[model samples]
Every structure is written in C-alpha cells, then in structure tokens.
Target: MTHPFGFNYGGKTHYFVFDSESGSLHNVDYVTFLCVKNRLSIPFEGGEAEDFRALEKEEIDEINAELDQLASQGVLDSPCTVTQKKKRTGEIKALCLHICHDCNLRCRYCFADEGTYRTADKAHMPVEVGLRAVDFLIANSGKRKSLEIDFFGGEPLMNMTTVKAVVEYARSLEASTGKTFSFTMTTNCLLLNEENRKWLNDNMYNVVLSIDGRREIHNAVRKTPSGADAFDVILNNALEFRKIRGDKSYYVRGTFTAKNLDFCNDVLYLNDCGFDQISMEPVVTDLPDLQIKKEHLPVIFKEYEKLAAAYIDRRKNKDTWFNFFHFMYDLEGGPCVVKRLTGCGSGCEYLAVTPRGDIYPCHQFAERKPYKMGNVLQGVSYDRNVSDVFAGNIVTNKPDCTDCPAKYYCSGGCVANNLNFAGDMNKPYDISCAMMRKRFELSLAIAAIEACEG
Candidate 1:
C-alpha cells in the first residue's frame, strides 16, 4: 500500500508518501494526501468534486489536478494491500566476531551482562576461533568482492594477541579467496596503550572508542576493574590515536543516560576535546538508572535543538561535520524498507558469532539461545526469530506499526531494543517510537532551515 505520513511546517500540512514495494517517496500537500487517501479507501478512481464545492470552481479544478498528479505517481494506496507480495532479501553480507566475552571495566549500565553473558567466568576468544570466524565471513560473504568483520567483545583489546593473529591470518587467505577484508574493533580504551595504538593504526581499518562525555558523568558509570579512573585513560588514548591516525577513520562513541538528558554539552565536550568525529547515541536499556523517562524526552528534544543550532554555527565557520545528518537528509535514496515483512538482516546478511563458534543473527543475540541461527562450523539453521526477523517481517506486520505513519522511515525499530524493553522481539515500545518521531521531525526541520539560510 502507499503509506502516507503527515506533518506540519510553516503553518502548513505536508505529507510524505512511500511505496514499500517500489521504495519510492512522494512529496505532496495535505489536501492531495487526504483526497487520495480517501479515494483509495474504496475502489474509487478520483476525488469527489462535491467535497470541494465550497471553493471557487477554478480552485476546485486546481486541487483536482494535483490529486490527479499524485495518483499518476502512485502515492494513492493500493486497493488490495493485504494481497500484495512481500519483497524479501535475506542476504548475509556482514559479520561481527565476539573476540572475547571478557571486559576490564564494570560500567553501571552495561547491557551485555558485564560481557560475561551473565555468567561468572569470562573467556577470551582464542586465535583459532577468530580465524574460523574470518573464514565463515569470507565463505558467507556471497558475491560481494569485499567483506567486513568487526572485532567486538566485553572489550576487543583484552584479547589483543588473538586480534593481531586473526588479522594476519585473514590476510593470508585473501590471495586464494579473491575477497578483501576490512576490519573494525570496538574497545573501551583501557588497554589502548601506545604500542597497541600504533599497531591498530597501521592494521585496523576503523576503530570505535567508547567513552561517555565529561569526566564526572563518565566516571559515574564507566570505571576500571579496580574501581579507579577510566575516563582519563580513555581520553588520553583517544587523543593519542587521533594524533596518529586522525579522526576520520575512527569515532569517539558515547552514550546518554537519564541523568544527562542535556547531551548537547557532551557533543560540545567532544568537539572541544579535539575530536572531529563523534557519535553520542542514546543508551538502550530498561534499567531505571539509565532509561530516558517520558519526562526526560522533552529535554532530550531540546538538547537536539541546542545541538542543531551549534551545528549550524559550526557550519558557517566550515566546521560542520556531524554524523546523524545523513538521517536528517538523504541525498541518495534509502534502502528498501520491509518492516511489514521482516526485521534487519540479523540471520540473513549479518551474523555475530561467539568465541565458541556459535552464530546468532546479530551481536546482541550472539550467544543467546533460540535466536541462534547456527554455529560457525555447521552454518545457518532456521529458527522462528531468525526466519521472522532476518526474513524482513517484524512489528510492521503488527498493528502498532501498521497504524503508524512513520513506520516506513523507522522500518519497525530495533529488535534488540524491543526485546530489552517490550519483552517481545515483535513488539515495539512507545518510548522509542516517540523519540524517533521527534528526532525525525526535528532533523527534517533543521535540514530545511539550513538549506534555506545557508
């Protein structure tokens, strides 16, 4: 069906219609949207002229003409939405390796159960496991000439020896496989010493350094295993890494908790700390200490407003380089959205493998049972979550999404977030939905304002 989403700007209503089947976007006015939407309710072919009898004849004709144009562009809803076939591309392309199920820090809001998978003992992924994961990535990479594997963990740096060995081993297979590999590692920066930093600079394609903004806020949660200072060490490592490899190939990633809704300050904190690339995403958890409550939502919106203004000021000075801008405005077209049909490529195009060689759809599901797609040795075997999520069928297939206009844009939200908050992978929490809607609305407004003013 042609999904129509309505929003207001400059005291006028506008609609953004998307055809899920064709992956096309239609920009139209409120009247056109309503008329077409109304017309599509039945098997009617045109808007009723009697509805606009109050207007002058010429105005009625003008509106009718616009309605015709929208219909021609196929923004009008299909007469039979229920009977349409779903577009499914459950291709596997990317792989994430849980290099180790161990970490050094004891962060307050850690979601991975302190990286031990909620168990007492923590194990570092062996080099052979890494090598096998690399082989699995290449084997399942399909026709894609380049394959990517992310070294993830409680902290990947804890198993630096295995990481180094894997890189060399992956390279050794490139000649025979004819597939090039790109590597990324996410580290908490505790073990990011000068030696490790220099080696990673030359070997790794990209690095994700995780830290919270501002020292006090960071220290409240992220701390070393011995309960000592972690913020200072992480900051120093980031600075040193930037000096060697620069910020383009890396991002200083941070998270926002309920305590810090005014996260604009954190963005500025990172900018002032000589970081050109930074990403501060909202933490996804149900913990009261970290959750952004309904009351906190307004402040977070305001923070984005403050951040957008600062971003504009920076842009005027030729310093605007924000990451989420891509979400605000897309110069190129977006991917085919199939939320009514499936979730992300958890079991299909993406796989996250544990140290013991078991594979799940994504990193969040890496060692979790039932969500397990297959083991690295045996390859993918089907389960309901894997089939439903990886097949591109999810919450959009349900009422909460089907009734929401913004579903096309969000593509039914994250499975991990839903499972964490909503207790069902197929159901989405209203909190995340509202946050995304506001963010999308605000981003669109900011993009429009910048385009006009700049």
Candidate 2:
C-alpha cells in the first residue's frame, strides 16, 4: 500500500504529509505529524517522544480519531495502484538538432569530448541536411500544429549559417503546413557576434547560454582551444545577448560538479550577473575525481537547502526575484498524465539528430552507436523490440521507481542518464534519484512556506 509520506520540515515551523499519488499536501500539528509519519494505526508516542510534548491518553485518542477520519476520507495512508501504459508510437513533438559536432572551447568534462564526439575531427551539419531535417520534422509532426526544434551541439554557433537556413526553411513551410515552428538554441557565446546576435534575438524563441557560475568555476573547465580563459568573452557576449533578447525567453544555464559543492553561490552569482532565468545542473560524468560520490550526498543536500532558502527569500522580494529552473515546480498544474508516464519522451517523441543525420534518444545519448535509433533521412527506425521497450519504460514498470514518492515529479528520471550509468534505461542512477528526492522534498516545503507567508 502506498501511504502518505510525512516529514517534519520547515525549520521546525511546520510538518507536512505529502500524498504522492493524489498530489495532496497536508500541514499537521506535531502530534498528527508523528501519527502519520510513523504510520501508526493507534496514536502512540515513541520516536521524537523526548522532543515532542508528553501526550495524555485522551489526546492520543483524539489524534487517532482524526487519523481514522483522514484515512476514511482517503486523504492519509491511502492505497495506490498504477497500471502500466500500453506500448504505442506517438507523433514527434521536439528534436534536438546537433548543428555542429565541434566547439571553439575545450571543456575538460565535456561529454561530447570537446565537440568531436570522440571523432578524429570536428564536423558541421550541411545546409542540405538541415533543410531535410526541417522537412522531416514537418512531415512526421502528424496532426501536431506546434513543433519545436533546438539547435544543439558541441557549439551550434560553429555552423550558424545552417542554423539560420533551417529556421528560414521551417518558417516558410509553416503557413502551408498549418504548423507553428519555435526555435531554440544552446551556445557557448564564443561566436555570438553582433550579426548573429541580432538574427537570433529576432528569430529564436528561446536561447540557452552556457556559463558555469563564477569566473573561477567557469574558467576552470570551459576555456579556449589555446588554453586561455574565455570567461570574460563569454560573459560579455551573454550579457549583450540578454540585453537584446528583450522579453524573449532565455536561460543562463550552468553545470556544477563535485568541485563546487557550494554551488548555491554560483546560482546567486548568475542572478547577480542580471540573468534572472537560471539553471544549475549537476554534471554527469565518469571522471573519478569529478563524479559526485555517495559521501557527497550530505553536502549536496545542504547546498540544495541553502539554495532553496535563498530562492524563497528572493521570491519574497519583487525587485530581487529570479527563477531557478530546478526549484520551479507547479503543484496545482503540471505535465500531462502521458508525460508523467513516459518521462521525457526520449527515444520516442523527442529525438536528437547528429550532424551526420544519425538519431539518438537525446543529446546525451548522441554519438553512442548502440542508441542510434535511425537517421533523419529515413526518420526513426526503432525496431519493434526497441520501440516496445521505450514505450513501456514508465515509472510503474521500473522496480526502483514503483514506490518512490518523487516518481510522478521526476517521471522516471532521464532515460539517457539511466542507460549511460545503470546500463538499463528503466533503472535510475541511485545518486541522482536521491538528489532528486531531496529537491522534491525541499520544493514542497518551500511551497508550504510560501502559502503560509501569503
């Protein structure tokens, strides 16, 4: 049986019981918190007995009665059963187009191996191939009227010509095809000059600038091929782009590694740089020293708590407000049921296309031959076996995620990360899962704090 998960949080100011299945959050007093947290059938004091007030027998009976009422109302300690969704193919919604498999800077921990993807030399997507990709997206989009194409790579700016061509080609077809195209691009800012900046600001719906927080933090890994720090150039370019970006959406995305356990400073640093929409993701790598280990969980958890509190403080002040991508969770409205079941739609609705037209489940899975679903010319050629596997990769189908309280929130985690680390797409990396759970807990606590403040 799936019961409500209760925990004492909010700096001891509040206790919460989160209903994972139904998405209900309950704020209870200390006694009720204990009753629900311990899953006691009858009110009993054992854990936290010393910390909590001594309960009289009559008070315990009242608590038990309240618990029974909640249980009967299906609000507490409720049973949950999830049915596995049947395998099926769906229309593609988005594509991450690797416009160039080359980068100007050489990042030490680049999963793409400095844009070569382990290849001997860099490559760029030809304009013809890009046009074909646009056509492929339009043709395969089916009844979907809105389509998204993200220009990704070691650095898309390396082949800015093809990026612009693909955008124009897709835009030309929108009227005839009765479809709307939204473009997004991720760049390192090395080539974000005046000419391209103006074009991108006008055409691109959203832009993601890659900057790893503080100067030392960013310069430590991201640097020019000449082995010189490119932090100043990238920061200046990003600031310029942000100014011209007007109201169009953009994110100053950063990656935190084991070296920066106090990554909250990085987030705040980005915010101080005038980039309000910020995202700081943990680096996923196999490098021994860079990998976040089991011993690091406590520090990481503390850092997350620190970030959450600062985020709450900022939100309380209108002038100093900013958005942290990870902490932005909508409790009242979230992803659709289908999205929650299928996770990120990787290897299915959302696929990544390499410069050479090879398709992978997502950008992280790109260049991995075994995960090559197919090519853009022929479209996704996922065999029935592979298709069925991806189709059935739901939280309910995963043993580890079946009972996880964060299942719905994370949607089985990232499939590409799962395949790379766990050797199974359905299985999640335990460390990542733990971090995600902590984030979820803190997000809920923050929400409660906000509600209380209001």
Candidate 3:
C-alpha cells in the first residue's frame, strides 16, 4: 500500500507519497497517503486542485462548489489527489529517553506522584535499554536528518551511569551510521560537579536546570532531600557550569507555584546571576491548589503582565535576558506556520521513552500508564485516540471557545493541565482560561506597538 501525506498549501490540500528510493512523489488518496506512512488517515473536505485532469469540467466545477461551501463553513482546505513524493515518516528527529524514574527532591508539586511509580520495573534504565533505544533511533535515520537525545528523569543524573552509557552508545551509533546525535539533559542541578561539567562541556551537551527564582523564594519550596537549602548549591553549580561551558545556551526552567507568584521580580534577578535563557511554566495541577484560588486569577495575571512588561523594558536597556516574553516580543509580525502555533511539538512530532522502555505520548504523560501508547521493545506505533487527547480535542470544540477572539492563540490550553485539574483531559478550567486571555491581550498590545512604530 502506498503511504499518503497531505499538507495545506495556498489554502488547499496538496497530497503526496513517500518515494523511499528516488525521493520521488506519487499521487494517492489523502487517507491512503496518511495510512501508508502509518499516520492518521483523515481526508480534507474542501478546496479546488490546480488541475482536474481526472474529471470533466462540470465535475471539477461541482467539486469546486462543494469546496466553496465547506470554506463558507470555516473549512477551507480540501485534499487533492496528486502524485508527489515527500519525506518519509520513519525518521527520528527527537528521542526523549527516560533514564531514571526516581527523583531525589520531592517538590510540593510533582505529577509523577499522582501515578504509580513503584510498579515500574528498572527504577533506572540499564545501559542495555539505552543502547536499544539509540539503536532504534539510528535505524530510522533515513526519515530523520538530525537526531537529538534528551535525558529526562525523576532526576536523570541520579543514574549517571545510564546517561554516560546512552551518550557513548549514541556517539557510537553516529560514528557507524554517519548520523548526527545531539544531547541535552533536564536536571535539578544538584548533581552537577566539576567532573560532570567538564564532560558535558567537552561533549557540547545542552543543560536545563530547575530554579524557581532567588534564594528565599527558591529555597522556600525547592528543598533538598535533606530538607536543607537547595538554592545555594543549585545556583552555585549553575553559575560555575556556565563559566565552564562558556556559552549562553544553558537554560533555567522556573516552575511558578501559588507561593512564588508574588515573587515575579525574583525571577528577573537571574540576570544578576549571568543566566540568559529562562523558561517560566505554571505549576502543573490536577486541581486548583489553595494558592491558585479563583480569586487569585486577576492578581496572578496582573503580576505576570507586570513581569513581562518589566522584562521587555529591561531588554530595551539591554540589561537582562528573559526568554519567555522575549520570544513573544520577537514574533510580532511574522507569518506563523501551524506547527509553530502549536507552541510545543509534543505528541505530533515527539514521543517519550520511559526507563522500562514504555513509550508514552510525551514527557508530561509518561507517568500516567493509561496514556502509555506503546513500548520500545515491540517498536512504536501511532494511536489515534491518544493523538486526539493531546490535540486538545477534548476542550477545543467547546461552545465557550468557539467565539473567543483569542481561541487560535490559546490553543485551548494544555492537555496535561486540564487532565490534572478537571480529572478530564478535555475540560477547560478558569486558571488556563484567564491566563490565556491575559497573554493574548498582552501579545496583541505588543503587536500593535510594533505595527505603529513600523
């Protein structure tokens, strides 16, 4: 069976097939096109093809009229029956390997605890498992041009042996297959030392550390296993690691809990610490915490708006670097591709492999067994149900959002957040709704200023 692929171009669906040998194209049905590549076999409903050689002029006009009707109903792109070659689907661009399931620090807010982590075998993935994962990625290099292996964990560095083994194995695979492998790790940064720093720097590994903000705010929540100050050690190591790596690509990921919402200014203080890229993510919640009360929405949004505004002002003075808001500021007028609008490439373009070789949709869903799509042992397969769950289909088609001006920008909020808070991955909550509104308003305001200046 020929695999089918389709994309929206010039406001119409253009279909093609994967010519594995010659990189040539073939025409096929939209469903067949997607099915051949083991993707969702859905067909586009509207739009006219540039050429209608297969049908009479009257038939072509009829199809074009149907396309026009669908376009009127807000569906503009219709699939075309065309023979064209495109990229294969088996290519592995990103491999998120779960090296360890055991984290040292028990933060007040962690999603892993909501699910059973004890029943999971191999608390830390053995070197052999990592090798197998890397091997699968290497074997599928034809579809992928470049490969990236991200080290994730309860705390990944907790099992440094597996990290080293995977890195070495990936390097070996690269050498033999003539494929490129890039490595990155997300850690609490407590395990970083001179030896590890030197190794990571030498290997050009990208590192992301979890830091809430300044000392008082950071330590108040992000405590060490011993219940002591985790801030000093983590901060000190991050500072030293930047010096050792001699690059600004290293990132600091801050998780905003209700306790630290008032301390947005402390988040900006990282500028004084010499860190460049910083990511601010709201606390992942299954339900509203006492701190994230409904009354707090206005306060939180105002605080976030203030912080974002101040960060933009600082960038004007070239005094500090704030990555989250900076990105929004930068993308003011550019034509946004659909994939880019999704913000994250989670289930659509990426998957996460657990320590035990269990495959889930993405890192956020790794802890939930019900969300586990497949495993590495038997190879991975696509799951339409899982895809729909992640696509925000649960909350997206809601009546409330249908008329919202910022619907496109909000993307119906995060699936994980909805699932966690409402106990249904498809439900929308007040927090995300409010946050989305605030963010959209701020983004539009910024865009307006840019337009006026231009």
Q: Highest TM-score: give the candidate number.
A: 2
Candidate 2 displacement at residue 400 in angstroms: 0.4
Query: Could you tell which candidate, 2 or 3, scores higher by lDDT?
Result: 2
Model 1 ranges off by over 4 Å: 1-72, 75-91, 325-328, 336-343, 377-389, 392-396, 403-405, 450-453
Query: What are the per-residue Cα lDDT tens digits for candidate 3 across 79-144?
Result: 322222211133446778888887777666666651225445538888877887787666645556
Flag regions of model 3 displaced more than 4 Å: 1-92, 114-122, 139-142, 175-178, 286-291, 325-329, 332-336, 341-343, 379-401, 404-410, 444-454
**lDDT of each prediction vs. the true structure?**
0.71, 0.81, 0.62
Error of 3 at 440 (Å): 3.6
For model 1, how does the per-residue alpha-carbon lDDT over 340-426 read when each residue is reduced to its tens digit?
344455666667888887787788876678787666656534344564555544444556776554565676787777777888766
Q: What TM-score quantifies how close candidate 3 is to the native fold? A: 0.71
- Sorted by TM-score (best first), the order is 2, 1, 3
Note each model's CA RMSD in angstroms.
Answer: 5.6, 2.7, 13.6
Q: Estimate each model's TM-score.
A: 0.80, 0.93, 0.71
lDDT at residue 12 of model 3 (Cα atoms): 44
lDDT of 2: 0.81
The 10 consecutive residues of candidate 3 with the worst lDDT sum are 79-88
User: What is the alpha-carbon RMSD of candidate 3 to the true structure?
Assistant: 13.6
